[model samples]
Structures are given as structure tokens and as C-alpha cells.
Target: MAASAGPVLSREEVDRALARLGAERDAVESALLSLQDHPGLRLLDGADLTGRTQERWAVVGQGLPMLWALFDRYSEALASARAVRARKPRPGGPELAELSELLTGDAVTVPGGAPDGPQRLGAPARLVERVSLDGLMDRMNAWYATVLEVVSAADAVWTALPARIDLLIAELRRVQTLAASLGVRVGGHPLGDDLDALDADLGGLRTEVRSDPLALWRPARVPAQRGTVPDGGALATPSGVVDTERFDLAGRALDGVRLELENLLRLRDDAEERLQGVGDLLQRADATLAEARRARGEVLAKIAATEVPAVPGPASALRERIVVALELRQSGQWYRLAPLLDALEDAAAKELARARQSLTEVTQPLAVRAELRGRLDAYKAMAARLRVAEDPEVVERYEKARWLLWSAPCDLRAAAGAVARFQQALRPAPGGPDDGAATGPADLVDAVDAVDAADGTQQGGAWAGGEPADGQAVDGRVQGGRG
Candidate 1:
């Protein structure tokens, strides 16, 4: 509000002030027309507004007509001043003084309020007030800003929310179809429950958005100190924005649906791979069991050891479970089938492992006896190559070892010891009399003879059928003294 104490305007000064007021009038008219034509304002007019926007807009809407009425009055007063000045090329002192009073003083009349009307813009009757040109412009500007703020905020929500909601709804439909294929129904899965909730929330939100967009807006604050009323009331700041909470909730729900869909796809791939793995495991078990049965026959014929382990049959129960799981997958019972497949695969692998272990156990004694026979034959061939196969001690050890190794019900322990003795009879002494030129079989035979003559004296019981712990030859023959 301007103070009334200032120097009086001369004729020229009054003329200049009138020109400035005229410019201000032009600007105000243009601004008002712009506000009336604004797209946001148009949308607000058509929208079924609710909540805080509805309350604020009602007050703001009442004031809009008053803005134009005040502007018309301002134009009329300016036109009167201009006509009086035009009566002469330049106005006289009295005319200038009157114009100054009109520009500076309370010359504009706002109509009187009803006796029991609501205060502020809500009042139906025009409130009587007299304000200067500058004061009226300030009030108009403040009201303009307040109304524009609310209109723009609501328009923004309408523009942003509805289109986004539609897109999410489209995506939700696709997911629902996929969920149906996977047998993910509302009562069966938590994903279905979440989807149902999201559908309801989104449907309601879209309807609310289309109908009452302003209801979704959350203003940051009504800013204070824009301007003060003549009645000393502070003009509050404009409301800012649409609430983000609903938008955020909708986005999160869509994300949850997307994540679950991806999980279902991964489960589908895993289920197929595991099914194949189970089949391979069961097949391997059958092969291992067959091999074990064959090895049992071989062990009975070759190995003298009694009580060979029996081969286990393939696990038919686990195979049957795999068939059930496959049927479930084919029928699209994925949730029920997934765990069953896992259990089947694990059982099949264990069964295969058990069969392999049984086969190894059943064949092990035969394997040992075969190894002993191989060692006996290899030693005899080595003795023949050395030409010590006919040496009396070498021949005797070889014959006794052969009898134990080649005979039925062979004592593998005795056969192995006899073979070891023959091997010892063939090796030349480390530094004996025939240590020289020993590669030929005759020198090797003589080396054995020399080691036998020493007889636990020269070689520390290493050769010559060394006495057992009971001090007799192990084969129950005399230690052959060198001929």
C-alpha cells in the first residue's frame, strides 16, 4: 500500500503518470486474456476436480470475473481522464490536479459486500473498496499467480499419469497371459495375489486420474510473502506439484510382475535341463549294474576269493518318479513338477554312484589275482631272457610260484610271496663276485649262485630262499647251497 504523503504532481508530471497507467492497463488486459485462454485453465474448467484443488479452485474461480470487472472500471476511469485532457491541447492546472487525485487517491469503486457473505473471493456480493492503480494491479497479479499455479499442477498430473497407467496395464495383460500358461493362478501363487492387487489399484488409480486429477496433487507449500492484502492478510505462495506416492506404487507393482515373469521363464529352462540330467543318470545306473553282473561271473571263474559282492539292480522307483514329473511338465503343472524333478535327479545320481561302487567292489579280488598272474609270467620271461630259468633255485621258486598262481583256489598271498622270491633269485647282487658283465643270462645265473652260497651272510637275507621267521625255507625246501 502506498503512503499518501508525497509532493504534488505538476501538469507535466500528471501527464506522464497517466501515460504509465495507460501502459499498465494494456498489460493487465493482455495478461487477463492470456489467463482466460490458457490450456491449463481450460483443462481445469472441464476437469471434475477434487480434494485441496477443488477447495482452492472454487475461491480462485470466483475471483476471475472480478478481475475483468476491475479491469473495465480501470479502463473507464482512464478514458475519462484522457477525454478531459483532450478538451484542450494541454490541460489547465485544475484539470492536472484532478487527474493526479484520480491516479493516486482512492478513485476506483469496488461494490459493497452482502451482510452475511463469506470473506475473501468466496463472497458472492462485490466487496466495496477504493484502491490506487498500482494497488489494484498488485492484487490482480497475486490472484493470477495463485490460480495459474493450481491449474498447471492439475494439468501436469492429467498429462503424465494416465498415459503411463495405460502402458503398465498393457504390460500387465501380457504377464497375466503368461501366468495362465504357467499354471500360476490366483489361489495357487503369491505372484497371482500381487498381480490381482496391482490390477485393482491401477484400475482405481486410472479412473481417479481421469475424473479427479487434482485430488492426486500434493502441494509442497503455500508460499507466503508474495503480497499483502489492504486488510493486512498475507498472500500465500502457490501450490506446487502432483503427489509422487501413487505413481511410485504403480511403478513398483509393474516391476514386481516383471521380475516374477522372468523367474518363471528361468524355472522352465531349469526344469527341462534337470529332466534330461535325470534320464542320463538313470541310464548310467543301468549300464553300471549290467557291467557289475558280468564282472561277478568273471570273479567267480578267475578269483579264488569266496563271497564276491552281488550287483544291485537299477532303481525302478526313481525312474517311475521321473515319468510322473515329465507328465506334470507336459500338463503345465510347473509348480508341482519342479520340486519333484529335483528330487528325482538327485536320487538317480545317488543310485548311479552306488552301482558304480558295487561294480568296483565285486571285481576288485579278480583284478588282484590277475595282477599276481601277470607278475609271475613277467618274472618267468625275465628269467628266460637272463637264461637263469633253468637254474635249480630259480626253477624251483618259479615252479612253486606258478603252482600257487595258476592253480584253482589260489592263495594269492603265498603266490605273491613265491613270485617275489623268484624275482630276488634273478637280481644280481649289488656288489657280488658276478657284478661284472651281468647283462647276459649266464652271468646273472652265476650271480644268483654266488648270492645263494653266501645265504643271508653276504646279502642280509636278501636272496637264496632266505629262512622264514621259524628258520625254515618258506617253500619247505632246503636252502640250495651253490653246486
Candidate 2:
């Protein structure tokens, strides 16, 4: 941004400035030459670029010729200055001033922003342009930097994202092959659909990254880093090189598909064990069902006027499905087996839970009687603690409830009503510390104890022997549903 037209120089200073101009001319030419041959620029030149890169690079391509023309103009001006100096021995004031202006002032005429060559930077609308020697050098510096920015940013993205995507594509190929061998699917859709989508997205991304990399960059608030050309001199710093959010998304999606395929492969390795576990769960379910049937008989004999839920037959169908799963596993049809195993395992677990629940249902009346008895005793204890046991209403209700509860073949529905009556009389009377409010009943029967009547519950019921929660395989044995 700084452009200074320096004061008149001495002859030696003028000569030094000219020599410096020559050095600067060489530096500019080298920078431009390197840019012309840069691989990234070559790609840009041929590619049908899109988006912001298309717009910006078009300006660079058009503007490029002006740089060469200006460089030519600078050389001629230097040659003319040299010729004048050589005309007089130990040149005087006029020769020195002319040399001084040629070194520091806008002493050259360059091609304009016309139809043929690169445009003058700011005055794109102008046909002709003039800049001092220092100005010409500065212009080339800025122009070279711009060219590098486009070329470097595009190459950076090409380097960063495409190679990773290619590696992912390679991994994807392996996954696809594995999936095809096993006939795997993701949520009922073949992996080919995902592969197609991934190919389209990543392929499009690679092309776009090559052609229009600037579109992927983050907007830079600060200026890009100025770099020296490989040969010599400065080039423009490339702006916001690569923003990988899109690339990252595509990569993760690809990984997810690959992981899904891998999971199916793993399922093949352990399908037999998994099927065996399912068999174990079904066996446990059968045992629990038998226990429920036995318990129902006991409930019918012991609890009067109580309904017991019917126990289902053994979970033979679920166990039978294991044969099919084994066949699939043996054939390496992992996709089919994976879903089947999922359904079969789920069914086995529910069967166990259902069997346990049936046992609980059949024996529910006995549990109710026990719960009512406990509540009755709790209320009695609370009454004694409150010194209300002697209240005639409490005494009468408690005795009647106790008689029914203690009887064999207890009518639980009637007995429950009697307990409720006993509890009603135990409420605090109005106009005391109680103030007519019924103090809540004691913490009795808050929960019906988990009625696991199966052979060995979790403590002694369903899926005994360190039950695996949810029909999961444990030590190659499936166990779950401690009800």
C-alpha cells in the first residue's frame, strides 16, 4: 500500500537504484515463470472451473499478459536510461535526474485493460496505463501473489481432501465386497444404494475441489501469508485454503456404512453362539412356564374365589427358529441371519418375561393375602404406637380383619375389603394434633414383592444362574428377565 516517490538522488544513488531495478526485474520474471509452470495453475488453465474460483481465475488469466508487457516496457526504459548515461562521461544534473526518475518514478507505459492482454489492476476500464519503476515492481509483486493464492489454495485442497476420500473409497470397496459376500443390507436397503450415493457425493467433491477449491475455503479476515517464490522473490499469500466440514461429513457417512457392513461380518463369526444363547433363553422360558402351571394349581387350591392367568406352552417355536439361523450362519448369509437373530433373541427374552409374569399372575392371590396381612399388622403396630389400640372402632375392625386373614382358603377379595375397613377406623379423629386428617397408612405392601415363582428366581426364579440381562449371551449361555 505504501508507494513513495523519493527525493532526487546523487549519481551513485541513481546508479544503485538502476541496479536494484535490474535485480527487481529478474526477481519478477522468475516469480511469473514459476507461476506459469506451476502444476496447480496448469490444472486451472485446462479445467472448467465453477463458482468463485471460476470468476477469480478468469481475471488472473486475462490479467497475466499485461504483466509480461509491463515487464517488457520496464526493460526498454532501463535500456534507454543506460544509453543516456553512457552518452556523457561523468553525467551531470540532467542525466542524473532523468536516471533518478527512471529508477523511482512512473516512467514506463504498459498495455491497457483492452481486449488483448491482462488488465491494469484497478483501472480495468482503462485502455492504457503508466507506473513508476517501483510501482511496476510493486504491481508484479501483488499480481504474482494473487496468482499464487489461487494456484496454491486449489492445490492445497486437492492435496488435503481428495487423498483422504480416495483412501475412504478404497476402504469402502473392501466393505462392499464383504457385504456382497454376506448379502448384507443396511435397514433393508442394499449397500449398493449407499455406495452409489457416496460415489456421487465424493466424486462430485473431488471434481469441485480440483476446479473450484476457493469455494470450500473459510473467509479470511486477515491477509494471507506472503511467500517467496521457489526461485526467488515474494508471491501473494493464499487465502483460507481448505475448509473440511463437507469432506468430514462425507467421510463419516462412509465410515458409518463401512461399520455397518463390518458389524454384519462379525455377526457371522458368532451367529452359532448367539443362536445357542437364544436356545438357552427359550429353555429358561419353558422352565418358567412349567413353574407357572404348577403354581396355578397351588393358587386354585389355596386361594378361594381367585382367578389365575393361564400359563403358555413352552417357547418351542423360538427355539425351533434357531435351526434356521444356524443354516444361514453355515451358509454365510449374515444379512439374513443378523435380522433373524435380532428377532429371535427379542422373542426369547419376551417369552421368559411372559413366563415369569404368568407365574406372578397365578400366585397373585397368595401374594395379596400376604400383603393384606402385613398391612393389617402394620396398622395394628401403628395404632399401638399411637396409643389408639383401645379405641373400640379400631379394636373391632382389627379383630374382624385378622379373623379373615388367618383363615385357610382365604377369600382375598373379601379379606382385602376387611383390611381396608380396618385401616379406615385407624385414622386420627378431628380436633386433635390429627385435626381430622387421616394419618397415612404405614409403609406396608408398597410393592407386591416380585412374585418370581419359577424354579430359581433371579434370587430363585426365572433365568436362574447369574442371568444375563435381556437374553444377552454370557459365558455362551443366554439369560435374562428376572421377574
Candidate 3:
């Protein structure tokens, strides 16, 4: 219902509008310069952008020059109006009428005018119906805003991606060097192959990201609320989103390499421990063999009748294996050294145990003779305490056992039988004339008899009250049954 024409301005109103117009021009000029000098805009101009960013920038590039052209036209119109008012001390009715038209009316003119009239800057084909000074300013502000969106998006992608890629590349190189030192070849270890593949992939991905950042960006659509008519929504941001999945994959690959390195270091430590154990076992075996050799000479000289086993010499073959294992450890072949050290440790322990067994076997008869001598004297002292050392049968058996046991080239088999017979004589005769209160000697005899029973002997008369000298009922004859 309002008139199509602009409202008329008095002199004061014209002057006020001019001041306001000049302020708008200054602000607009500052905005234009800032947009032109913006880092994002500079990057957008020089960068080899791609995909949606490339397409959008092409449109923005075309629109930018048109926006500048329109701003120039707006500036010229304001200047001409200001000059007309400056000619008089005060604007008259005629002067005010002309100023009113310039201040509020359609004032911007396109140079090389269209066949119809003034037009939008770049779209000369579509003639502009009418544009006032204020309308032109609004159009320029819109163009500036749209161009800034594209420029900022490109700059944001550039800022976040390239530096991150460089850091990842540095980490990848460090891992690659470590892998090579560990003998992890591309075709040998799966992790090595994976690292190699990642190297190639990261190289290509970095190039792609640098050259065409927008192509890698993901666009997420925010869901509209239910039960509301959805308006055409602007994007949350025009900037490219980083390809986080690829970066995470790269980080995971490096972590795997780091884990492998840790495992190898642990293996190296275990290998060193195993080598130390192998050395200890081999040294113990050598010492055991030396002791066995010394015992062999003593056994031959003292027990003339016994055949001594020859002490085995140090295990030269096993020693050679230890040398080889040590070499493997020095060479950093932890995998190879681990199994070798295990085998060497087992073999060395067996050799040491065998040497000890040989020494025990070769000197066994001498030990038995010594044991028999002590048993004979122990029973003699026992019988003397019991007032029965002068028993003729016991003396005869004792002397026979002693001579066989004490003489060099002692017949140990005969000596063992003599000692057993002497021990049997020391037992109290069942229903024979040897009854009295039990003494310490009888208790000692019972203790020796208990030992004999454990060795599968069934002695007839060791205890004064007899149940075959033990608690067992023997052959239905209970000589000393509990009352």
C-alpha cells in the first residue's frame, strides 16, 4: 500500500543521510581491504583445491570482482551528491530536492549501460530493476560474507592437516629404522610388511591432503527436530574436516611396531639370563667331573677288591655348544639364542649329575666297610654295657666281622654277613637264660633291631618281651603278647 518512490528529504535530512552514507562507505572499504588481505583468501587463491571447495571457490572468484565494481559505483554516487550540496551555504528547495533524490532514490549507475538500464555487476544479461545507494551496500555486504565462508573453509583445512601429516611422517621414519635393525624385512615379518605398506600409503595420503584438502572432508548432516517443518539448512561449517580414521590407523600401526620392539627387548633380557644359567651349569659339571676323578684314585687305593668306574672327562661337545650359544647372544640373535641356551642348560645339568653319580658308585664299597666297622664297635660297646661282652659266640662273630671289614681288599659280602650274624647274636634268646629288667643296652638293641626290621629283616630276639621284637604277631607264636 506504500508509494513506490523514495521519501523526500529536507536540507538537514540530506546532510544527515550523507554523513551516514559516508560512514557506511568507510566501513565497507575497510571490510573490502580486510577480505582482500585475509590469509584464508590468499591461500584459497594460490592453493590447488579440489571437489566442493574448488567448485564453490570458482563461483566466489567470479562474484568477487563484480562486488568490487558495484562498490566503486556506490562510492561515485555518494561523492557526486556531496559535491552538489557543497556549492551553497545552505541547500535551497531546488538544491534540497536534488540532494533528496541522490540520498534516498535509486542512485547507482552501471557504466556502459545495459539496453534496459543498470544491472547487477556480473549478471549484465539480467537487467537490475532499480538499486538505491543503500541497496547496493547490502548487496556488497552479502558478497563479502559468502566469499569469506569459502576462504575460511580452505584455510582451516590447510592449517590442521599438513602439519599433522609431517609429524606422522617423522614418527613413521623412526619406526622404520628400528624395524630394519631387528631383522624385520618387508617380506619376512607381517608387521614389517604392514609398516612398509603404511609408509607408501602415508606418502600418497599426504600428497592428496595437501593438494586437495576438501576432497577428504566428511560432511555430517545434523538431524532436524521431529514435528517441525525443516527449513533449508546451511552447513555447520564450510571448512574441510580432517580424515581422522586414516590418522588413527597410522597411530595404531606405530603402536604395533612399538609393542614389537618391547617384546624383542624382553626376549633379549631372557636370552642373557639363559646364557648365564648355561654357563653356571657347565662350570658345575666341570667341577663335578674333577671331584669324581679324585675320588676314583682314592677308591682304587683303599678298596682293592672293588671295581671303580672311570670318571668321565669334561663334556667337550657340550662345552662347544655353549660357545656357540654365547656367540649367538653376542650377535643379538635373541630368537636363535633362546632355544640353544635351553638345550645347553639341560645337557650341562645332566652331565654334572652323572659325574656325581659316578663318584658315589666308585667309592660305595669303602663307605659300606666303614659303616660295618662302626656297627660292630657300636654293638661291642652295647654288649659290654649289658655285661655280655665276654660271651664267646659274640666275640667270635665280632672279631670275624671286624677282620673282614677292616682289612684292605675286604670281602664286603662276607663282612656284611659276619656283621649280621654278630647283630643276631646280640639279641636276647627267646625262653633262653637272659631275663632281667630291660637296661639302656637292651633299648639300644631294640632300636638297632627296629632299623634292621625296616630293611626287611625278621630278627628273633631283640626285645626282652618278644613279639618277634616288633608289634606284629608272628606265625601264631606270641612270645611277649601284651597282658
Candidate 4:
């Protein structure tokens, strides 16, 4: 019997085991105390928790007392072994046997064996339940870990979401105040009914997050095997754990409201400037139309046998729309005024452009008649410069051309033809290059006819009154020139 027991543990081995067990008892005690002092645990204890955390905490709360009870039992068991081992420097076989049983055998008795209530209500239980030192430690570790996980997850949400929700709610109030000042309206309500609804809902959402923070708990994207507090909480970060979908929705809605308010405020600032721009455009358009009407009358009085496009009247409709838009802006109906001003500005710009175009078209006939008059005078000057001003054919053609040019309501085509004839009569006519290249008045008439035909129809060759270009000629004598 002595040999069997001595082989179980030598003196040094028995002392080593007691020291290790004592260290383990101290470690377990420290761990439990730290858990009790944990901020997450204290908050969970005080909070009126809701949802899954509420359900799980009820189970954890009951086990706390039993957990302490089990620790006391473990400590007592360690104390007995320590006392026996301390009795003498070298313990005898009976003392070693007792120490061995206390340390290694099933030494702690628990009344129900379960910290929780019995599994079956009416079922009979054993008279006694005994657990080894290792078994009790394992059970306590499991109970401690289970309780802390619930506490940590709940604390993670409480700490993160309510603060964010408060900030969002405060921002909503600012948006509301700014909207009121801007006179911003959406669909008959202030900032639309949704913003109001969100304002109200966000206040309630904050309360919901307080009571039911676990509902917002979600798994991390990478799903860490363990977490920060080491309670096996799996909340890699408190911020990462909250499912902020509602908070994010509220934020988006609030941002939209702020952005819209900013746009309306800018519109209010720029409204007068934009309206002034439109008014200036309308004034310019009206002035342009007046100028066009006067030009139309001048073209009719001064030019003959030419078509002039008539000017449309000033854009009265755009002016009326601008007036309505100004009234809407003054009344602070920015929603109505915004689109109206946009259309008004566009129409006013187009009206200004249209007025300018009308002025250009209306004066075109006068411009053409002036060009013909200038051409007739240029040819007459060329005749005088060439010293043929008094030749009878030249004089006759000049008188006819002068009659057409000087007369009001001139026939420009007949005048242009008469000028061409007079011009041809001034210049010596083309014959063969070897014939000293001169022909009489009938040939001059034929040359004028050729010029009128080419100018009126086909390209190439006119009476330039110069030597032919490219060694080519009109009837082998003249090169075409711009008149």
C-alpha cells in the first residue's frame, strides 16, 4: 500500500502540484473579479435590455450567484489540500493520500450540480453531486464566458449607435430651421412629408437603439474567431458590429434635405440677378425688333423688285411669363418660380436672337441695292479713267445705267445689265490677237452680251479690260476679271 501511494506522487512532485494548483486558484479568482468590474457587465446589469440580449441575459444573470458559489467551493477545496501539505516538510503516506484525493479526486460537492435549475421539474436528483477541481474550473469558465459575451455585444451597440443617432437628429433640426427661413416647400408640406416623418422617426429610432441594441448587432465581414474583450464576443469592433441601415437611411435623407435647402438659398440670392438678365435680354430684343421695322420701311422705300422678309412682332408672351415668374419669386414660391425662370430665360435669349436675325433679313434688300449702285459708279469711274466718258455708245449706255441707279425703287437686274454694257463700251473690244485686237461698237455690244451671259449663267471669262490670262481669251482676246 505504501509503495502504491509513493509511486502516485513523490515529495517534490506533490509540492509542485500544490503550488501549481494554488497559482491556478489565484488566477481564477482574479479573472472572476475583473469580469465583475467590467464596464460592459455593469452596464448590462443596469440596463433594461431588449431583444436577444434581454433573452440571453436572463439566463446569464441567474448563473452569476452560482458561479461565485462554485468559486468558493473551489477555494475551500484548495485550502484543505494546502493545509494538509503544509503540516510537515515531508508528509507521511496518509497525508499524501489525503492531499492527492483533494487535488486530483472529485473533491467539491454542489447541491443541484447545475447553476441553472434542474433539467426536469419532477425528476428525482442524486443525493449529492461531486466534481473534481478541473471540472469545477471548466464549468466556471464556461459560465463566466457566456455571461460576458452577452454583456459585451450589448455594450458595443449602446456605445456606438445612440451617439451617432443623436448627431443625426440634431442635424435634422438644423435642416428644418434653414428650410423654414428659405421658404422651401415640397408638394404642399414643409420640406415634403418624408423629412418630417424622418425627423419624428429618428427620435424614436434612437430610443429603439437604446432598448434593443442587439437587434442592430451584425457579424463582422471577416468574422473574427475571437474579439476584443476576450469574452468570445466575436465583435471585432464595436462600430463594425452595428447594422446601421436605419441610421444610414436617416443620414442620406438628412443630407438630401440640406443639399436641397442650399440650392434654394442660392436661387434666392441669384433670383434678382437672373431676372435682371432676362429683363435686359427682353429690352435688347425689343430694341432689335424696332430697328428691324424701321429697316423694313427703308428697304421698301429705297430698293425695287427685291423680296424682304417681314419682321415678327416683339415676344410679348415671354415678357408676360417673366412677369409671372417675378411675382412667384417675390411671393417666395421658389418651386414654381424655378422652372418658370428657366423657361423665361431660354425664351428671352431665343427672342433676342430672333430679333437680330429679323433685322439682318429686313435690311438685306437695301444692302443689295447699295451694292449695285456702288458697282455702277465704279464702272463709270473706270470709264472716265480710261478716257472714253464721251463716246456716244458709252454716253448712251451711261445715261441708261444712271437712270436705273439714281431712280428710287430701282430695277437692280436691268441696272446691273446696263452698267455691264456701259463698262464694255468703255473698253476697246476683242478681235483676233494678231488683229491689234480692236473691234467697233457692234462688237462692243456683242462683248457686253457675252459678259451678261457668263455673269448670268456659265463660269469663266469676263471683260477685264486687260490682256488675257493663261494665254487664253474671250473670243481669243480677254481674260475674266472680278467686276
lDDT of 3 by residue, 115-204 (tens): 221123234354453567766766665566566556655567677877888888898888778767666668877767888888898898
Residue range with the least summed lDDT across 10 consecutive positions in model 1: 474-483
The C-alpha stretches of model 3 lying farther than 4 A from their native spots are 1-5, 87-89, 92-100, 110-129, 215-245, 262-270, 278-483
lDDT tens digits, residue span 157-256, model 1: 8878878888889888888888887888798887788788888988988878866776776666552213323332322335567676876877787787
Ordered by lDDT, highest first, the candidates read: 1, 4, 2, 3
TM-score of each model, in listed order: 0.75, 0.61, 0.53, 0.76
- List, residue by residue over 1-483, the lDDT tens digit for candidate 4: 112222356578778877876776777677677777867778878878777767666666655676688889989988887888889988888887777777777777866735323222223556567877767776666566555555666778788887898898888878888777766644565566667788788988877777766677784432212222233222222234768888888899889878977888888889999999999999999999998898888778866766768889977778788879888888887756777888888989999999987887777655545655565566666556545666688789889978987788776556656765666565564442222222454554454445446434222233333222443312222122111
Alpha carbon deviation, residue 228, candidate 3 (Å): 28
| Rank ordering of all candidates by TM-score, starting from the highest | 4, 1, 2, 3
All models, RMSD in angstroms: 9.0, 13.5, 10.9, 8.2
Runs in model 2 with CA error above 4 Å? 1-8, 114-127, 185-187, 190-192, 219-232, 287-311, 316-340, 349-483
Q: Rate the local accuracy (lDDT) of all candidates.
A: 0.68, 0.67, 0.66, 0.67
Residue 127, candidate 3: Cα error in Å is 5.6
Question: What lDDT score is found at residue 149 in candidate 3?
Answer: 56
Candidate 1 has an lDDT of: 0.68
TM-score of 4: 0.76
